[model samples]
Target: MAGPGEFELIREYFSSRFQTGAQAGGVDSGVVLGIGDDCALLTPPRGKMLATSVDTLVADVHFPASADPYRIASRALRVNLSDLAGMNAEPLWFTLALTLPESNAAWLEPFARGLADTARLYGITLIGGDTTKGPLSITVQVTGSCDRALRRDGASAGDHIFVSNQLGAAAAALPIVLEEYEPSEVQQQQADAAFYFPEPQLELARSIGACASAGLDISDGLLADLAHICEASGLGADLKLDTFPIAELAQSMSADAALETALTGGDDYQLCFTVPAKYLDHLQGLQLPITAVGRMREARGIDCFLGGKPWQPRGTGYRHF
Candidate 1:
């Protein structure tokens, strides 16, 4: 018995499944040309600038090889969307470059379904991409449009740093996934859900575009990702430990362990951004669950403080090397 060939695999699993503007009730208006084209064609909305980002997920490195194909596919696409969210861009379309060890219909079927389901949910159409034989990996290029992009270098010294949601639940799930820790059933469910289905916070991003000066998604740990803004803006930050909207799963752990996970355990996928102090009232008016975790400062590095005293965390975040 032989595995399916590339074209056959695509026909059955990918090519025909991706929705078009016509199929989506003309919602995907920005997609000029989708799959089967030599190159995707996109038209940015009038007066809006295009925002593009690419992200790759490797087997075992980004997710466990034994993970469910549906969840993995969803995560791959969602993470790329998070990048656009950081720039306050509305997602338009995406391209996928998938490498597989071999063609297995059982695996590809659910994977494509997951990808299609997520794309439709966000009103993004699948454009074009490549398929090749290799180790399992997925690379997605997402294109979005915004009138003015939120950038890392825009934060000012007096701005207040905010995060969209609670942190460290995804990080806390790692120990359970590795069998290093046996959590209670409720705790396990909470952590696993956070790890597998992290939300991109697109609506929240759009609402803050005019108010936020600098921002990025918290794929890396909070401290590490915040450092990126500080480095780009030539400023520092002071994170109030007590102000962290720590996830309930992490809060269940020892204080030191929870803090460590919140600081260094990556994969949270929340938005971390800075708003000018003057706009704090405006930000509050949005009524989003945004938390003011810290303040940008004139210094050149990040400082953690607990009860007016400086505190140090164990690690920064995940590193590729």
Candidate 2:
């Protein structure tokens, strides 16, 4: 194949592929101009607020450098979308900045397909971005809209704490992802899904809506992330360790090991939120996969109880520094 120039590469693999999403738009959806221009023109809904987030994933640091191109694209976009979900926002549009060592058509084809498929599934459009020659890295900036956005500082004492679903799967899957541990076929599938196709909790956040006092997606460990909520809300939390919903991927580990991972291991991407006492019943009535594992307190720090006794985790959370 001929060496693809930057403009041709963008046209073939990005702009053209992203147009499918534009055609699927509704009357109220935004996007006066998208890819092919120097900038994207957008129209936010009349009364809705825009929620935007950006994430940069470098090769080896975020995912395996030798991983599948398709899965890489999926993980990259979905993780950014998780941020919008954390803020209780609906998907709108996103920009992609891709840095590559070389423009290999074989690689770009699958990567583009993966990105387009995910954008299509999430109902988000590809706006505009830049391409550069460098070591592999993907930077995605997503913008969404919301009627009533969730905030980190909205909790108070006597509020119930909840997580959208089971935790620690992505953390537990790291070993399998790095090939440090060999797993059964089913276990391997579980690991791949956890690490590659993590679901953004958009619907659950939408369901929680006005009833949620505070919320954030669990990119960090449960305890570490819960501390964020505590810090933001200016309150503490008392958690029941026994009530944690562990993921099946981590269930095969020793009980203590599993609990430790669930508490300190990061990358789950599920939503951790608080509901005031008065809204507890309303939140529960939604019948989501949420569980109240703790309660916000008047104290200024988070405390954990296992078997009715104080418990501690091995670590706080992942530190980039």
Candidate 3:
């Protein structure tokens, strides 16, 4: 059984499907040329800075290889979109670099639909990409624009730290996702949603961008990701462990374990940002799930205090190496 060739696969699955509506010949998607050309032409909005990020999710590494293709695509795109959100960037377009061991339509149909649907959901267009024969992996490079850029190097001592929504759900869901644990139906659903459809905090980032001193998405985990802001801004943080908003999915675990997971687990995709004291009232005015759990310090590393005493985690966070 011979599969479709490269060009045929592109036409059937990607090109024909994405080249519709405003994206048709770059009418409204800011594309001068999309797909089938040597390069993609795009127009960045005037007076706004361009922000771009790229991520590669390898099968069985970043995600379970046997997971649903649709969910995989959604997780892939959503996490990348989180990068834009952390920087308060508005997503404009993206390029996909898909490497597959073989071209299978059963996989391509839902995968392409997943990509297309997520793109539409985010109001981003697929401009161009490359397809190659290799191990299953998806690499997406997202480009966004920012009228006001929130960077990682702007934090200072006395700034407060916050995370959008809850944390540790995805890290807790890993056991269910890997079939190591069988949870109740509701827990299973929560697991799937947390791991497969992690929401990017774009609106929250935009809401606080004007006052947030520094920000980044919590892909690696709260402690590890916050360390990045510390390193970049040359300051440390002290987290109020008791005030931590542990996710319901993670709450099923033991109290100590859940808190540890919330602190050190990865894939939350929430925003961990620093805010000046001046904007605390402004942030409180918004009806969002922003939680202030820490404050930047004059020190050089993260400090965790629980019950007014120092606490430590078994591990800092997920490490690729």
Candidate 4:
């Protein structure tokens, strides 16, 4: 099949994808400002600061081509939102760079629909983006503006570490994709749903607000990603591996598989944050209960305790190398 030109491709596939209509009347939504001109226009509320982050989803790296395009769109946008959440910022606008092999309306329609739904859910707008012919990849840049922004360096020694939601859903989905094990109907649905439709915990992050000293969403496995916080905060971590929230279905897998999924696996997208022990009650009040997995110390290194024994990962999680 012949590929459509770039303009036709954008018109058919991406034009209505973000559903920024609520910001409308200017263009798609009833809002007053337009983004179609060479220079896009945006108006933000006063005293708000902008927090920006960019994420790239590469073919065979981020998601499999056979996976639902709608899911791909949702995950791509949600991941960026997750970052904003980690910083306790409110999302305002997003820009997308879509590289596609060819144009197919069937794939683009639901994809755009899913993208729009997520944007609406988070009260974010898609101001502009560029599309080009190439391999399948999506690079999303999300900007969240806030009066106060959270930073990783704010974490101090003696802070308690916490996480929202269970870990390893994305890891658990891998075997199903590889056809190694056939998941039960319910298990398949649970794993696949969480993997495909990741909830970035934007509200949870925003709610945590001042309670979170240092924060980040767990994309590249908990141990590795948290280590980034450790390094940045000038601290070390003592983690309780067993305290990790693993799903029951995921637990049914082999011990090695479960641990591997939990430790070295990536794409969980849950938030890992630190808060002063004095603020523990604050976190609990939000109902975002956290396992007292470990402590942050002035010392340097990552250590883990599994079943009351010492543990060290054989390798870092999800390295491209």
Candidate 5:
């Protein structure tokens, strides 16, 4: 079906989907002002500091236009939230900058609904933004407040590395999107869910706040994201591929494909962090299902080992260049 023009699309598709009030569709849980306001106002609970992050999802670059608009909208916002979660922050407010070739009310409605649902879950309020005619792309900048912000460079040489949940599901979805292979029904569901509705691990971040010294959401896969921590801490990491929390879905793929996808492919969005040995018990006691995939080392190079063998990947993580 052909899409509708812009203004009608926004009004019909977007306007009703997001109601700006605590009582209205639960969007205003902590929001002071919502939707129609010139700007949104929000105050974090006392004593917390704020951290902000901006992420852009471009058409063709981030997702194919054929992708579901609702999923796209949710992902656009959640990915930004993932950044905040990595910092062990509480989501507070957000602003969106959206560009589209044309508007269709049908598309915008579900998109706004998806955004509202995810925002409500994170207690984030939408403030102000600009809508313009252009190529299809979305940019969301989110603000989160925390008692203490986690930094990427806080890892010490002796810290232990941990990752939340599993990896490589998003990368595995690429084959489905590219139609290179037909995924089994279960695999298709896993891949599509990974691509569309990724959880930002906010609960884990809140639970591990002060205990987490250095952390980042793994948008660029394990090898690449861990390298960021390694570079930031001025140290090295020896990642044990066998210890990586590879998902059951990923395991169904060929061993080589799974390894490459887990190591070099991007978009996993799980938290990779360091905890001091002293807090190891607290971390372990939490029983968060995190695995010690690697450890911080005194050396200054990033390395990975799989099956007791060196894992040398030809390419690093996702590089726009």
Candidate 6:
């Protein structure tokens, strides 16, 4: 027997289920046209610029092939949302292109449910996209609006570097996920949680946009992502290794292992940004769990120090090649 057709699949699983909180006859949602259209029509909030980003996640390349569809859907959406947060943009809507080996209701049902739930939580509407038969992959293109976007080239020498929340939790979970390490139940739970549900620092992004000179989400490990800011700003960074905010799961391992995971492991969707030193007090007032890990310097590369001496980590980060 044949499965649901493409249009039937979209109508049942996607179309109306992902509508924004906008009324059908109203202009409040900024979405003039949503799913099922040949093209989606959106009106940007007056005087605000549209910030758009696209991300693609392939099975096994970005997530475990055997990962739950719900978690996979959540991760795909959240990671794209993280990009909008890094730009200090308010998410409005997104388009999803899904390629699957076959149309299975068992998988599509949960995937759509997870996607819809996450979209609602983030206040984003599903605008439009395509579905095809192929290797499993998901591509999300998100559009947000912002008055001013925090950019990579804005960091100045003497600017202080900050990262949101603890790092390396997701990295620490990788060994357990791959079945290479056996961790305690609590440790496993903590690491797995971090890996599965990365919270995009959207509120923090809005609060810091005015004060932060440069920023990016730490999807590619803190050190590697920070290096992007340094390179773009024509500056270097000196990170206080001892000040690295290690996650609880990472702390469960040896000090060296924890530090390595923190420095080189990827999939941590936190924010790494730079703010002028003068805004230190203002930043502190925000009361978010942000950590001042280092400062931008006049030199041209990143220099990490532990115990007042230069420290080199084992790996740089995850690379696509």
For every model shown, what is its TM-score relative to the native structure? 0.93, 0.94, 0.94, 0.88, 0.88, 0.93
Candidate 3's C-alpha runs over 4 A off are 1-7, 20-22, 25-28, 316-321
lDDT of 1 by residue, 132-204 (tens): 7789999999988888788999999989999988888888777665556778999878866787778888999
What tens-digit string does per-residue lDDT give for candidate 4 at 1-321?
Answer: 223565455754554554333353223332344344454566655576778999999978777877788888888998899888878888778887788887777877787888888888888788777777789999999887776566778789989888777776777776665556777898788777667777777777778877778888888888888889998989998888776777555677676556656766777788888889898886787776455678898899878888999987655323330
Better of 1 and 2 by lDDT: 2
lDDT of each: 0.82, 0.86, 0.86, 0.74, 0.77, 0.83
In candidate 2, stretches whose alpha carbon ends up further than 4 angstroms from where it belongs are 1-7, 20-26, 316-321
Candidate 3: pairs in clash: none
Q: Cα lDDT for residue 55, model 6?
A: 98
- Count of clashing pairs, candidate 1: 0
- Give the range where candidate 6 is weakest over 10 consecutive residues by summed lDDT: 19-28
Per-residue lDDT of candidate 6, residues 1-321 (tens digit): 123576457554676566532342135558776765568777778988999999999998888878889888998999999999989999888889988887788888889988988887888878877887889999999989988798899999999999998888888777776666787889778866787778988998998999999999988888889989988999999999887888887886778778878877788888999999899999899898998889999998899899999988866322331
Worst 10 residues of 4 by lDDT: 21-30
1-321, model 2: which lDDT tens digit per residue?
Answer: 123576466555676767733453555567777776557777788887899999999999999888999999999999999999999999998888888888788788898999989998999888887788889999999999988888899998998999988988999898888898779999999999999999999999999978999999999788888999999989999999887999999889888888888777788899999998898777777789988899999899989999999988765322321
Residue 240, candidate 4: how far off, in angstroms?
2.4
Clashing pairs in 1: none
Worst lDDT run of 10 residues, candidate 3, spans 20-29
Clashes of each: 0, 0, 0, 10, 3, 0
Scanning candidate 2 in windows of ten residues, the lowest lDDT window is: 312-321
In model 5, the clashing pairs are 9-105, 13-108, 13-109
> What lDDT score goes with residue 146 in model 3?
92
Candidate 3: C-alpha lDDT: 0.86
Assess candidate 6 and give its TM-score to the true structure: 0.93
Q: Which is the better candidate, 1 or 4, if ranked by TM-score? A: 1
